[model samples]
Target: MPSSNKNLSVSVIIPVHNGGESFRRCLSSIAAAVPPPHEVIVVADGDTDGSWCVAQEYYTTVLRIPVCSGPAQARNLGARTATGDILFFVDADVTIYPDTIRQVAIAFSCEPEVAAMIGSYDDAPGAKNFLSQYKNLLHHYVHQTACEEASTFWGACGAIRREVFFAVGGFDNRYRRPTIEDIELGYRLKQAGYTIKLCKSLQVKHLKHWGVISLLRADFFYRALPWTELILRDRQPLNDLNLQLLSRLSVISIFALLGAAIASLWWTALLGGVVVFSGVLLVLNAPVYSFFVRQRGWWFALRVIPWHWLYYFYCGLAYAIGTSRHYWRQKKQLAFGN
Candidate 1:
């Protein structure tokens, strides 16, 4: 029987690897949340830091993998053991609000047709560093502004009905790393005609600190490349958060901006192309900059511009590379049948 709004049970599943202090705070929040979850399942994905032992302090169900499997496998393990109507997936480095679980329950109960829903990070991140703040805040702004009818799912603070989750085959275990596993699962759910919503009000606080090198590495290899390949593989619609129309325009403009700057050395007239494309970029992304300004004033927004542009540049490069690689593999398979 479909659970009623008042009686919906939530099982909070957290996957951690070397959780450290953030894990403590994550568990602490879960322990303190009013109307506590029906159960808390912590999956330690090969934690040598004794995060699994620490999880025992909270009196929640803890599962441990001998070696580090990716979060997708860890989450799948936790989901298999969860006994609640709603399987709430929270990252180890993120802390949820006191009413997060309650809100998930009410949302599902009220809308029986909602198979899954994902939430955004709060505007105020736990880390105060520039990159950390910019990255996390960018995430918050994007989710806050995105369509309510979501195209992809987020693992940071996402929930799915237990039955619906398994019906779509859960997180693809083939994703052995921390990449776009959640997004892939969301795509599959939608393909199966399941409804996934972006629940903006159900927010969580992100606690991970981001360094520039780490940010670049994660964005290019772990994120952009894999996601681009996934989109081409599934022929996805570019209607999701980062794949929106404005972002595509921005990517094209950045490449054009680069082309003009490079071509200007031989022909001075092409220098005008650089200025033109720059203006196009600024106009295209004015809303984002304005949102950043509203969130953290002019100085912070100014700092975010270059970093944001660099992000688009790399995304464009990744798309080109991934597209080439995907087709090459397709051609190889057709010929070699491997």
Candidate 2:
């Protein structure tokens, strides 16, 4: 760790496309941080909702593109324009804790070997709906409990060293949408032998509202499928985050439970399958049940079990689709002699 007394300037980068009120609130919270960021860069990727105008009101550098170029490109542009040593990437919908920047400073100062690091979303999410709450809280729980020795990165609230970021070629601009851009960057960083830490203590509040349909769709199509393709394409080891052994086991158990129920021509089979399924879910996800109970009480926790089951089902479905697509695409390429 570089213990030089020289101050570390932090540049905060936010990319927005019609972020509206939440974008303003994000900037306001950034301004309220105790230590404050050295520079705040807001890139408006075709702002039709007037967020660009709001960016001007804040004492921040504002960049604009005529067309919506997607978040990856916007963040990349912001990175190029950033003058600070540390590039802190924050989503337009996240509210930073007052000490967030200060905490980031401490982490970088204390761990010189840590080339990049990311923080988890705080327990308090802005959305009050069940779908939004469940999705956001699940994210918070996963990141908070994940191995501190992280193998991937999050763009919602992550920071990286400027030199190392550029060395990895920043973000692959070919990702026209959010997709797995940040996670891909993290994989590259890891391949380059740079260390990334999941700073559980540092946190921010997620303000994006997630409807049930939208959440499931995004999880399946945008995140899970693309992320699966990325892993297979890179031939990277899938031992981190949700792809861990325990998670895979849980998915298998859930599917077995469903299959046993569907094929329950015999009463004995149904009873045996249900008992085994209940035992497995209880044993494996005791901590998750505890989290639900703590967050929304015992009654709500019991009620939310079905929803979590649905989540597992959808995740497995996405994995199957992604796997099929990957092989199909490869077959097509082979046929074409590419």
Candidate 3:
């Protein structure tokens, strides 16, 4: 394997909708990197905000879709036009570190056999608000602790060999919204025997701000529900990312606490069971909570508990709903013989 990335070429592909100031910073970061990308392809997917025009100012090859298409399509279009050894997919809202692309090129150049790799969000998020910090930090913790041999791909900061990407059909365009498109692509890549690495060292800064309603909507609809259906369809276990073993247990504990609360009304003894389940939850997730405390102090960690518990509660509910829908669709398909 070559020691340096001098011979390698990378094409950075960014898919944006209505990219605002954050997108500007992302482009600026690209400009500031030690070694610039071989080419920059920015796909503006039905942007009225003139993000496409801004992309032109940066000397990027800007492509536009008149009607709004999801990131999957946008990325695929960008990939089709790319002419580099590696296709580096970066989300528009994410800003890369000065050495981010260098790290990506190094990963590919040094590990000749690895076909893909993903990076995590930096511990220090761009947004300083409490919820944004907690959410982005949780993401950082998960990716940092996950197996180096990645089980899934993340579009926020991920790269793949160009030939291998097209050979596997790229991101599944059926996913109209941003739902598990990247994860599904990762699964397919693994099925085809391609290796993907979780390069924790190559971190990027997430520029998204989190609000209660937006966060919950994304978790329940865009993530949990679609994810549950995917697992059922593909016979995959809840064994990776946010749906890992510990998260499954946490979801169970949350629902059990709710059940105990309801039962306490009937017998009054189950009230103790509520406390027991809650304690079990706290113990089960002690590592993450401790992580929060270590990173943000006791007051912040304490404040995060109820929100974290609320996360589990909604996860459980979404799983229930997703499972029911999956079975119902299957039943209907069987009844109406095709």
Candidate 4:
């Protein structure tokens, strides 16, 4: 559907923290989008890398937070100062397609019942590498089949009615860290009887720049901790089947390597065969991994595959630790009635 001629004002809120070169590109893309946002709000969270200055050059309204708070807090701060009817939240690392704003506006206008809408990067072509492919496949598999009542919306390109955002009290500032605040907020919105629509047409190009170690560190600190907090607070079991599959894969791979090592003590050929077979299995799964890697090229795939497995392991371990800590803290709080 084409964009309506009616003026649908939208405030684009971008939270930045040492965003560097990517922030400028993100702003440029947003500016290029049709029916541009009424205003762009960049909430700079104690950016020491001169990101705030760069954002100021691109965005007219820049809100600077002295202390480096997480994106959740930064977004809330931006929303507080925004003057538009609709709030479009975009991560500094993501660039929206030219028609994104129009598509988002159309989706909201067409569906009065949808309190918010989420756009995916999976629609973009050329994400072919083992890691990128796997990432893309995961994105498509999870989101393409996502129910309207999903527990979380992708934070990269999500929009919500200003009223609905305020009604839900914005993102929970309690999350103080850069993690699953989006997921928690989505859960809250659903609890309040609001539906979130997934807009496949509103595509954003995500420049995911993570080598293996960096990715693992990110998962441990950002993703895992926030997820743990959410599961504990809501008492929701870790029921995501994908998590189970990862666990199984990690276990199987570890055992397979150990067996191969043991076999090698007696016969070098057996060990070599095991190693080759493992490599072949990973290669066979290359198509699945290509969805994530296609954007970075062959060099990234060569460097990232080994690290990805370790990253997943660290993520799982961190999640377990975080979950345990959360449960203990909750129990203590309940017992003391503080």
* Highest lDDT model number: 1
Name the runs in model 1 displaced over 4 angstroms.
Answer: 1-6
lDDT of each: 0.94, 0.87, 0.91, 0.72
TM-score, each model?
Answer: 0.98, 0.95, 0.97, 0.76
* Top candidate (TM-score): 1
Which candidate do you rate higher for TM-score, 2 or 4? 2
TM-score of 3: 0.97
Candidate 1: tens digits of C-alpha lDDT, residues 94-202: 9988888889999999988889999999999999999999999999989999999998888989999999999889999899888999999999989999899999999
lDDT of 3 at 15: 95
Tens digit of per-residue lDDT, candidate 3, span 51-109: 99999999999999998879999999999999998899999999998887778887898
Encode model 2's per-residue lDDT on 1-338: one tens digit a residue: 34545467899999999997889899999999999899999999998998988998988999998899888999999999999878999999999989999888878877888999999998989988877787788888888889998999889999998888998999889888767899999999999999999999989999999987788778888898888788888888577777877777788889988887877765655868977896897788888889989998898778678888787788788788888999999999999996
Global lDDT of model 3: 0.91
Better of 1 and 4 by lDDT: 1
Task: Give the winner by lDDT: 1 or 2.
Answer: 1
Candidate 2 vs. true structure, TM-score? 0.95
Q: Count the backbone clashes (under 3 Å) in each candidate.
A: 0, 0, 0, 15
- Worst 10-residue lDDT window for candidate 3 reads 1-10
lDDT of 4 by residue, 1-338 (tens): 21335456788999999987778888888878787878999999888998888877775699999999889999999999999877999998878878787777777777677788887765443334445544544555445544544556557789998899999899988777677788888878877888877765566776656444655566778787667677667776533323444444654564466578788889887787677646754754465457446645667556656655555556656767887898788789999995
